[model samples]
Target: MKITKQNIRTALWVTLSVLLVTLLLQNSANVNLRFLHLRAQMPLFAVIMLSALFGAGILWFARRRR
Candidate 1:
């Protein structure tokens, strides 16, 4: 299987979209998971944007190396 530019773009968009939706749903529903005595709360939009930015940064770094 050959990886093309279009494929990469499509994958990136799909991943971002899914992440955004998940984050929004989780935030709106007040979803929370606690382990031990630690607790965390994040806004849906913030989480989604941060994750997407992180992913894009990593991808950019990888592409730059090649």
Candidate 2:
């Protein structure tokens, strides 16, 4: 099959997804998380994923067209 931009993106996404899954599976220990005034216990993977989601959301909001 001929290579295209969409195919490249798909491959990258799949690779990232696999890597993320592996990381999450390997790290599941609970840790104390402090957010502003609230403190709570959260899984290590959950904390990382939440931070990633927040970062992605911020980037999308900033880059989206008005």
Candidate 3:
């Protein structure tokens, strides 16, 4: 198989996903989030996943159109 950018990206994503899953499974505690009086209790994994998704969304939107 020829090495390409797509393959590299796929490999990286897969590795990151596996690592994230392992981390999530190990951390299952409730976390408190208080932002300027707005408070919430959420699973550590959920918060991490949501933050990652939010960052990805921002990057996706910020990418220059070609």
Best by TM-score: 3
- Candidate 2 residue 16 Cα shift, in angstroms, is 0.7
Instruction: Summarize candidate 1's per-residue lDDT along 25-50 as a digit string, tens digits.
Output: 66653335456998777565665667
TM-score of 2: 0.85
Query: Where is model 3 poorest over a 10-residue stretch in terms of lDDT?
Result: 57-66
Winner by TM-score between candidate 3 and candidate 1: 3
Error of 3 at 49 (Å): 0.9
- Residue 31 alpha-carbon offset, candidate 2, angstroms: 0.7
lDDT for each candidate structure: 0.75, 0.91, 0.92
Query: What stretches of model 2 exceed 4 Å from their correct place?
Result: none
Tens-place lDDT per residue, model 3, 1-66, is 999999999999999999989988888899999899899999999998889889988888889553
Looking at model 3, residue 16 earns an lDDT score of 95
Model 2 residue 24 distance off true place after TM-score fit, in angstroms? 0.7
Ranking by lDDT: 3, 2, 1
Q: Over the stretch 32-56, how does candidate 2's per-residue lDDT look in tens digits?
A: 9787999999899998888878988
Stronger candidate by lDDT (1 vs 3): 3
